[model samples]
Target chain A: MTTAEVSAPTTEKPKRDKPMGTETRVAWTFIAPGAALLLLFIVAPFVLAIWFSLTNQRLISPLPTRFVGFENYLGELADPLFWKSLWNNFRFAAFVVPAQTAFALLLAVFVNQRIAGRVIFRTIYFTPITVVMAAAATIWVLLFNVNGLVNGFFELITFGNFAPDWLNDPTWAMWAIIVVSIWQGVGFQMVILLAALQDVPGELYEAASIDGAGAWKQFTNITVPGIRNALIFVFTVTTILAMRLFDQPTLMPRSPGGPLDSTRTTMVHMVDLGFGRQAIGRGSAIAVIFFVIVLILTLIQRRFLKEESAQ
Target chain B: MTADSDVRVSAKKSVGANPLWRWVLYSVMIVLAAFFLFPLVYMVASSLIPDDQVLAKSQSFEAFVPTPFVGLENFSDAIERANLPRVFANSVIISGLIVSLGLVVNSLFGYALARLRFPGRKLLVGVVVALIIIPFEALAVPLLFMGAQVGWLDTYQIQILPFIASPLFIFLFYTFFLSIPRSLEEAAMIDGASPVEIFTRVVAPLAKPAYATVAILGFLFSWGQFLWPSIVTRGVDVRPLPVGIGVFATTPPVSWGDIMAYTVLMTLPLLVIFLIFQRQFVQGVASSGVKG
Candidate 1:
């Protein structure tokens, strides 16, 4: 059956009242600006990048460009640094995604309660979300200083015997980046999860409590199950963010890469290739490959993390 | 339900629970809250200090407090050195242009899909969904090359055009329009209004909140951009505040106090907008389902 017959004489009829020619023309006219901009920005750039990835487009040159199909990919494949940087991205994602999720969920749960100063608490947690990464990076450098608040916390608990230069120490730098990433990142995810958590029925918790369930049990069995979609959404977004791994690492250190190239992410590497070293073709190749990896990672995450089981 | 109502239930339940437990929860929450607030506190504190005492050992209990108060020299100096006013002007212009143009393109596309029927409508919706996942990082390189090819480098259009429409923004409008009743538009049409007139006068007026959400979102995006502008802008001439700050922070003779002042200056307007429209901001983020 046609759409008109199947869905006859409702609000849908008004839209179909016009002749096909007029409707189509109106649709095109309405869509023209967005379509044109999308084409110019998204589609054309995507096609251009694919073509550039196949060729040798030096950032600067008297040298003419040539199509070196698969050469760039092969070179990237053989480069150990490429692998290391990609692994760095993976390491970042692995650490950040779960940590961010757990902390965000905790914050959301806490603020979701009947508590004094809940608005104040909510705003405090969310305040960091307002911070620009550049400002965040600058602020964090002091926090990691030997005599900074990190060590201040240490002194309050211990003797402050071991204060390390966080951004400069290769051993501590990645951890430092992870710390900063979580702090700035968690607030946003918390807000999302909070919005989801609010949608869940409070009566379920009350009923579970009446059945002699503890808070932990209720959280695990009820709250977790209730906000399962939001959990996936938060987790997926966090993972994708980790894969990108740009601004936090870029800004956290005395320089862009952190100490001893320990925090040099795939994004930094891409920037180094495209802008720093002026090898546009190699960078384009990296970007495409990076996109594929993210796509694959997202698929794997969805397969494993989907809420189908919850249903 | 709000926390007030939730808390009432918990308070009743806690009548039989331990009294100390509630105190402990509040303490932990307060400490963690302070931890999250530290950087913002530190930025403002540092900015209020004299340049000499900014990074120096002070007589205060904490590292953030300075011994002497500086009378906004840092703010003045930072503005002069970074030419922050000019960069702020650039940011305002860029964000303004992006929001104004973005609303036009995205809203039109949304109105078409939500209200009009044509061939390829489903396919176009699919395209938007697919495009939404294409992160700007992945597209950065090719876009840069395209910018160079088209001689758009160091131009305002380079910053403005690439961000004029996004699938998420279109979806936001599309969803909003779908929620709007169709009979209103039909009545408008029967009153001899054109379809375009129905959209602008009839539909768009009712969609003011949607426009505000998109506008605030669009403004935040264009203003807060760092990496893209870093790539595309050639130098001080076209660089917005964040990019200019990124570059400035890297260069030598970087004064901590001045940097903090710049941070405060750059951050306050956004913070104010956020505070004033926190509800709309939350709606924007939730509806778009993207990170800030």
Candidate 2:
């Protein structure tokens, strides 16, 4: 065909492409209910929260509610427990996020193999994903209790030489939270990574093996890069979740903070401040700050991920 | 030739194929599996043991083994003392309403964003998508303030209404619906069906996977939730299972076995439902790439 004939087919098709002919009236009607809910629940609460964070509001006190102009924010910064929980929150996230990511990635690699009982193993590992945080928290509390199965196993392995109070001891309480979190959380990321792994071509591995790359080398080079999007997604999510870590720590502590505030997390501190003391202003301030952290962390992760993909 | 190849396949499948490596992988998985199960298995085994036995074994890994003696005292006490039945029913009702209503509302919104052209459609989609990352804790205080002002507190509507149209669920449905061909909706339009009719009869039915995903994820989320219910509701009238379990921690005469028993009772229903529809759950969560 002539060049004009070939170009004509592509050029003319754009004009004939059907218009997206949806009616706006019907569309508005369809979105109305959900839009209303989002407005009332998500948006309204978010706006109100920022407003409340500036006030001296109490849940049921006779004190008149009035704006305090970031006093809650300043007050929280000075409060030792607030700062302690902030560090504790960061410490918890730092410990759990990388551990869970590495653990899940390793698991995804193993189960991604054409191994025996993969189905059974996947199911077994994923049981915790279905568990309520409250339920998982209860079980872990028992296991971490002095002389419970957790310590018993430690002692058994050490020939009766070691056992620590996993829950009550400040030194071990944070680690207990970390370990159970890894247990409860790994299955989720593993499942995501496993799906990501399936998208990697078998031929890539074959080519690497033929080129004399060892399993670890092939994994680092091929598998990791292939699932880069998923890795970022999982890591970012795990971090955000770790920041808000509650339920597990909440159940472990006799008080809001695990003995001496060891296992206290940011959101848990916010909850204690907000509901326990009915200090709505400070609690709202804490939440708003944490929300900013989550927002920034998520955006940075997305940017980093985009750069990786762009590379 | 077929029989010979089948024999080779069986050999490859067996632990004998690569005996050493196979053994290592198997042992690793088994060990890992046992580690994963340790908390839950311990819970069940500990719950079966008498409170005294559980306490006695609390310091040992031997605590994992159900005692030489066992009884249902924990289960009975949990049922009686904690008012387990009431909370369980309350949780079921709340989860049920949220899941069922949630599917309809979210799917409708998702459908609009996916298939329709409207004024501010892009803006609305942006709003929903943006709200997805704002954790409920961030919203709780103000939501409480809002709920109390509207007299929604101490009621099921307070919990149900706020969550019924989850931004994430809408996004999930939107993703699923976006992949659906416009031709299908067009065909229904040509048949003179109204938009809602086209949605309900044509669009919704074809989106079975989306529905299943939304249902399972919604159920798990609504059930697993502690923060919101803990914030909104008080007294036994509207308390969910998790909150029910939590309140006992502060109350006097706390019994560990009873707590474990309640945990088991609270957890078993969800586990069973999840297992029954696990494929849908996994597939739903897989594409969403985030746990509810």
True contacts kept of each: 0.46, 0.60
Tens digit per residue, CA lDDT, model 2, B109-218: 99988877644566666677788889888988777777777788889889788889899999999988988888988898899988889998999999998999889878
TM-score of chain A of 2: 0.91
Candidate 2 residue pairs in clash (backbone atoms < 3 Å): A147-B58, A147-B59, A147-B60, A148-B58, A148-B59, A152-B61
Candidate 2 local Cα displacement, residue A292, angstroms: 0.5
Clashing pairs in 1: A114-B7
Q: Could you say which candidate leads in lDDT?
A: 2
Assign candidate 1 its CAPRI class: acceptable
DockQ for each numbered candidate: 0.47, 0.45
Computed on C-alpha atoms, the DockQ of candidate 1 is 0.47
The superposed Cα distance between candidate 1 and the true structure at residue A42, in angstroms, equals: 0.6
lDDT score, candidate 2, position A157: 80
Of candidate 2 chain B, the 10-residue stretch with the lowest lDDT total is B7-16
- Model 1: CA > 4 A from native: A1-18, A301-311, B1-18, B58-60, B250-253, B290-292
| Cα lDDT, model 1, residue A235 | 88
Model 2 residue B251 CA deviation (Å) reads 7.3
